[model samples]
Target: NAMEGRVEIFMRNEWGTICDTLWDSKDGNVVCRSLGYEGFTGVPRYNSFYGKGSGRIWLQNSSCNVDETSIQNCIKSGIWVHQCNHSNEAGVKCVPIRLVNGSSIDEGRVEVYQYNQWSTICGQNCSDSEAQVLCHSLGFGRAMNINATAFFGEGNGDILIQNVNCKGTESSLLDCGKDDVTVQNCSHHYDVGVKCSSVRLVNDTHEWEGLVEMYDGGAWKGLCAQNWNTAEARVACRSLGFDGSTAVTQPFKMNQRIKAKFPTYFDCRGHERNLFECSHHRIPVKTGWYSNDECTQAEVRCIPVRLSGGYSNKEGRVEVFMNNVWGTICDAGWDSVDTRIVCNTLFGYSYGGTKVSAGHFAQGVGDILLANVSCTGSESNVLECKHSLMTDHCTHSKDVAVKCYQNIRLNDGKLEVYVKNEWGTVCTYGWDDADAKVACRSLGLPRYYDLKDNKKLP
Candidate 1:
């Protein structure tokens, strides 16, 4: 074979070697022409054959794009068997068929290709949470529906898993498994089918969490905490082109918070490109406050982030309901308490000390809009700014964006945090005692102040 994978060849007549240089799709065409094979798949790599012969005539090379006759011309001195056995033969593998359909197969469900075959797995231990993960892995949004007991009719393939430890929202199927084990305690009666969901952009809210999809790549940004009004918030939301936002909330301490994540504010013009491509600014802080009631109108921006877009690498959409518009929040106020709201809203879990920010630290955009924007500890919307504007040469044009955590999954089974637009895997190795005390205190949990894990220094 001439091109695609790496290989060496020697001609039977000259015992000389030649290396394939012209490797391309054209080479693949030649392969099909000489082989009389229909439908060109693509060039695969890896030595297809290992040549073994006497002195130097170890192998023969030909352009993959050549016809059988052209290949014959390359070796006029002698004719080698078309399928001769050798140790140094060029090798290539046909690519596996990629299933374009976005759907999930459950514990027992099975489907047959053109080939009439059948196989099934036991759904005895499959849970909806686990099913959510499996479905998402299949290029679908979270699983919206699940059917079991041969729902799709039994088909074939090894019952690959059993007693799966699925967490429903896992990023991948392998994450739930124990090392190399597969097909755990499964039975023939378990068959499952999943309904894949589509991705949709969402804004942040007190009761709900929004996902971050894209990043602007700079300092962690902050939102305008000045005497903002709902009108400005709406403009910002519209500027970022978010469908709309829920009640704006004042950012509190997120237990799993990381410092300097996300932009201050987002500016979407509804007609602009996605959020990542839209223009954004920062919210300046002064005198422990954003802007005073001196300004009436301010501009904001947004980015279109996909929540369940089948791109695990992509962050979820995480926006804060700042002003009336949905703006990105900086990780400025992120602390254990703030992360508590995120975990509770997204994972339906009881608050675990906001685990370490197990996600990327989105560069911050600006400082918090207000140093002490008064909140009843639960006020939504950062506009209740009573503090005076802290900046000098700032205007609505310099409004900062906000960042949020759409969803985060942590090491403690359900511990999670948001940083930038991405979710991070928390580090358990270096977590120490002082951090624990800070975390516990942030959660309003009585400081254990005694346990080894909760030890305090000085």
Candidate 2:
């Protein structure tokens, strides 16, 4: 009564109806808007969708332009009509369809409103074209798959429509060509469902590594890690616009408590545009797999990290981009071994560099990512280093820094120095080849052959 069908008006203190001669969604939209509903699409009903009214027919052959505000302003003669009867009563749905029982907003079973009740669409003869329209109408890109056998789960009430033939270009499912409403001949077990490519990574600050959630059948459901592997993770990373997943970890802890549903196990060949394209077991049957538990949560980590705020390209304050934002690392227990991994990964320097602290270069602006970082000096990246989870106890004043010696060079045979990110000649006041040899060795160059007086060199 509030959201679906039956256009009625009050006249002479009695409820009346309108004629269905020219009723449509455009006309229904005005009524729905008048009732204070947004994003409303009106479905025209011919045979008194609400019920047969007992009073005079107040409007007949009502025509409304899209911009018109009210049905009262849609009469042909701008006057109430008494020429129509209750038999020709018109009805309209303010909000006709919705996705229900799914994991996310863009996914769910297709439900349509008719006869003042919600009904499911039969999976019989349902196709991608029909699903495309449904997904697009729900503000999703397109339909990833049309599940015919109630993949999301069965629905209650009547099977409203069957054999829906959509051209894939329609705005709504009602716009698609379909059989008459009276020809309902399908069962609830054959209820139609849709899966959209609206995927998200939750819990972790990094975009790549987190609990994987997919929008399906009307809600956000977690993906199970039963058969999840690096191949599947790679596909997920590629889907999210990354090169590929570096690691596929299972049972990753979620920051917030969640009642995860739909334990889907993916079987991927390492290449698929979306997760749904990968063959999957909708409900995994692994031992100890719980449908409503977080233990089955699967996570993936994509490789994305950088060194910033250093004097040279080889070294600086370490920052990682995750959850669509950049953040720095804390120096709580930072050391040379931890800084070595970052220097090796970015600068290709075999020897480990020195660890600087207290924002040696300058303070970073955002989050202090890692605290108590500890590496074995053999890791390829700083992410491989063991570190405490970021906490508010650390601040930018304790931001970690590194000074890599990879950029040191001699300029014009002079004992030039490169520190604090600049090039200048060493004072040479204390002058000896032993000091020169040590400097040359630090620069990874051959030992100095001779030490000449500064006047002789000049």
Candidate 3:
């Protein structure tokens, strides 16, 4: 919260404000940096932008260099106090998001700060990836839960954002929908309340495996291996932003003398998003020592899922993260419907996706996690698609790839459909205005379109 406000300093045991007389954005950058934030668009607010400050005018005539480490180091006149006329005071807008009215900073109704005011993102139509972006912006690892029905109560002012679609890799909420900004006059009933958690693997050289140290009650605590199992591991890895078909959770002996413990007496069904929501009592303050016999820590490793060997990020070999660790999937049943789910889940939402040839983009070095993935054109994620228990029945020669028709690349085409790894031009024999409208809607194009019946193309 200190990131955005009128500039103030502790002088002679009292809080005081800086004069806007010589303050500029360079000074705002120094202020932001001094508060331990990367230099973002630090816009300096002049003449009581955040309302007049009642504190004494402490410093005046400051000409700060953008490269300066702090405002104190900038070229400024002495902090020899000034008259308080309430005319001009320096302020800034930096912190983009916050979690309000929750038991912890990681859980609450989401609030956003933009253009010098705090507001809420209204809409229950949010995805898990979008929620994860929100959590990541707040320095939390990922979203564990989203309370869509105004769970944390109402927020102040008008709804700030609506219909936002984050690609899940952004650093802040302010960076969303740069190409397509979303706005609406949504009601407070659909306020987004979210819960987030952070996880870190400890004492291991591998990137994905270590003794699990879940942040809880304001500190990182070892997960008691009392009932730690595959279910809990699934939640932990998802909290770490990894979505694979499976994860490995086992008891790891990291006998510590005085580390706090998060005991899991077996509640997670492995289908939940995060570990904390699996049900448990509040983790008390730092307490007794934990030995391997009394409290063994949990060690978890998740096979990360990602797209690799792509050109321009739109199409790629759908590689499983564990290069050679996991086996390949049988591409015998992979379909465009399944690819649509993959694109919608991994990439941003798209009108439709085509299942390109196995070797279309680039052959995957890692095995594809999908095993005969089949969807009925209604699944939200590929994980929910039907899959066989069999893997390693395929090869890199059959390593599947995809091309999501993201947005309206073309308003009018021959309307070719991808089936059985081959593109075929659709017959326009019975095509009509209704069919044309459906095509336009799928591509998210304008409603106005011309339909040419019985028209032939070369």
444: Cα error in model 3, Å: 41
Q: Please give each candidate's TM-score.
A: 0.23, 0.32, 0.33
Give lDDT tens digits, candidate 1, residues 214-289.
Answer: 2212111233333334443433333232333332312233323222322234444433222322333333222122
TM-score quality measure for candidate 2: 0.32
Candidate 3 residue runs with Cα over 4 Å from true position:
1-110, 113-196, 251-258, 262-266, 283-294, 305-318, 322-458
Per lDDT, the best of the predicted structures is: 2
User: How close to the true structure is residue 263 of candidate 1, measured as C-alpha lDDT?
Assistant: 21
Candidate 2 Cα errors over 4 Å, as ranges: 1-300, 310-313, 320-326, 345-352, 356-360, 378-394, 403-458
Off by more than 4 A, model 1: 1-119, 156-160, 167-171, 178-189, 201-458
User: Each candidate: what lDDT?
Assistant: 0.36, 0.66, 0.62
Q: For candidate 2, write residues 1-458 as lDDT tens digits.
A: 58666788776777767876556556777887777664355545554657777767777767777788878788864345654556556777665676677754446788886777777888888887898788765535556667888877899867768889999888678889987374456778888898655466775344556777765434566766668787887777655544342223233454444456544567888766556456653332222454335555666655445667766666677776554445788888776667667766655555536666655677889677778878887765676778777978978887877766764455566656656876667776887767866776565444456644334210
Which 10-residue window in model 1 sums to the lowest lDDT? 211-220
Indicate the residue-level lDDT of 4 in model 3: 75
Tens-digit lDDT track of model 3 for 1-458: 56677788777998877766556545776787777665343545555667777767877667766478877676456775544245567776565566778754457888776556667777656777778777665545556667776789988776767776778887566676732233454688888898776777676355555788765323466776666777888777766556533344444445543335643233677766666456433211222333233455677755444455677566676654332243445577876566667676655444466666676655655435667778776754555567765466677788767766644323245565556755556677897778777765554343644644555322
Worst 10 residues of 3 by lDDT: 282-291
